[model samples]
Target: MPCPDGNAGSAGASPRKEPITVTRITDAALEVVATEGYDALTIRRVAAVLDTGPSSLYAHIVNKDDIDDLLVGRLSAEIVLPEPDPAEWRGQLLDVFSQIRDQYLKYPGVSRAALAMVPTNLEALRVREGLFAIALAGGIEPRTAAWALDAISLYVSAYALEQSLVLQRREHPDQEWVVSREELMRRYTADSFPQTRRYAAELTSGTGPDRFAFTLALILDNLCPSA
Candidate 1:
């Protein structure tokens, strides 16, 4: 029988393409999370991107958690860890955290995946190692260093996710959305909240970068007073 295009039968058939690999699956999953939120990321969604079945993705990644781990691990790998300088450990710690937050911001909603996750992946371990080393070198006790690392990671991830949510809301505004800090403060002042009205200026004081730097300095000062 002739082919549909009138070419030779069988000979006109296209060659089979390479099967989807874990890396390709991961890329698709990240893309979905970037466009939608992390909640939209699923094996089925990723499979749809590859024109495959969920089972195909499952064969490589165990489940949604595995994909989340991969996404966070890939992001963690991009962080540029500063060399452990004892005198500059405080600044280095802030730099490390800033890099982490910047990486999470790049992918919009990916930071949500790192919320309660432990650092089991190699790249994540490297990030933790760098932070821990900096803490210890700056005279932090072992127990305090461990807790500080956890606290810093949690703060950075949560802050990045919060920023992503704010950006998302701004991009797709709703009736309930408050457009500006001025409007937010106006509403607060109009309400019956005495403390909020009194400190409205202090509450809405700084730009995003300024608030970030102020908070970072606060944490560093409290954690490593001598440093």
Candidate 2:
């Protein structure tokens, strides 16, 4: 798909088929994602976007994994990690997680590269170091801090992927698949699900941000002393 005139960050019609550089390759990959979605990302796809061939991409990046690392590294550079504040560690973390989520949602499905992978790039490691420093400052033990950060990162990545899929489904708008609020309530009949029926309205009340914050709060509550 040809991105509109100003959406340079999205999929292009292979318009930037110019000289190959690591930076250009990264941008082309993201544009491919923005235009064709993340599932369509590949060595050939990115090379096509860059107006080059797959072998040319391999000269700079080892493979698709390298591209994933580069993409995460680029995004890590964009996230402004706050100075470690002992008293406000929870809030600080909330801000960081929110920032990460927003960035991942921008590219869609890119967070999959981060799951179960070591920080392959300096920028990505910087985020981990920043999170560890903040958590440690808040009195969390070293080992706990490491595991907590990993858990939170996992959830954040999973959440981004799920959200991206939901967005794609919403774009197509299939009524057969989507359960409307009304439809959901009707399914929660008292006989089959009494307690769920009682809290049907409450279950569906929160907006996406509200639910995101609630989950983050649950995870962050016990980490810091003051919470």
Candidate 3:
């Protein structure tokens, strides 16, 4: 079959050619995601970046989900979990969480995708297995460990997504239709939630790492039997 228009082979029979390689499409997609956020990630955009056509991308990646999965898999390769240290499993877990967050933040939109996927890719699976091992070694019940990992993953991914979304909005200030949304919320919240108004500074006290540490401490206090 002929390759899609605007993506014809540089020199070949007819206008047809194989789809762009896995690396090219993914790198292009990552660029778009990092620059434009997930909503801007599309086959056409990736094709534009790759000098290919949407059909060629579809020929290799089934749809948006496939591209998303590929993106997540590519980004997963960056995560580096430390060796499971039985004596310091909690520290190890926090390190892994921070690593995952930092790596995904570089790509901007990958965290949102990671939030929705179970991370079946090899690297993600290995990381999950390692965390499970640490949890088990720490004397956590298998079921509890599994659930705690889920909770932690959800928290990290959601926080990353929200962070990216906020950054994107700030980058494109015109995109925010509700100009007074934050101020309005502050006023309403102050009136309706007096205690929240008083303690709002404390509520939003910490940076990402600080908040992550607080979260870990809270969960560990509940989950770790010795705590």
1-227, model 2: which lDDT tens digit per residue? 97667766575455554578999998998898888788999999998877677998877988788988998998899989999998899899999989999999998788887787887799998998998889988989888888888998999999899888877777786533666778877887557788988888987788778888888899889775423
RMSDs, each prediction? 3.4, 9.2, 6.8
TM-score of 2: 0.87
Please identify model 2 stretches exceeding 4 Å from their true place. Answer: 1-17, 174-176, 224-227
- The lDDT, on a scale of 0 to 1, for candidate 1 is 0.83
Q: Of 1 and 3, which scores higher on lDDT? A: 1
Say which candidate scores most in lDDT.
2
User: Per-residue lDDT tens digits of candidate 1, residues 25-84?
Assistant: 878988898788777888899999888889877777787888888888888889888888
Candidate with the larger TM-score of 1 and 3: 1
Q: Which pairs of residues collide in candidate 2?
A: none
Ranking by TM-score: 1, 2, 3
Runs of candidate 3 exceeding 4 Å displacement: 1-19, 175-192, 225-227
Worst 10 residues of 2 by lDDT: 9-18
lDDT, candidate 3, 23-72, per-residue tens: 88888999998787788888899999887778887667788877777777
**Clashing residue pairs in candidate 3 (N, C-alpha, C atoms within 3 angstroms):** 3-16
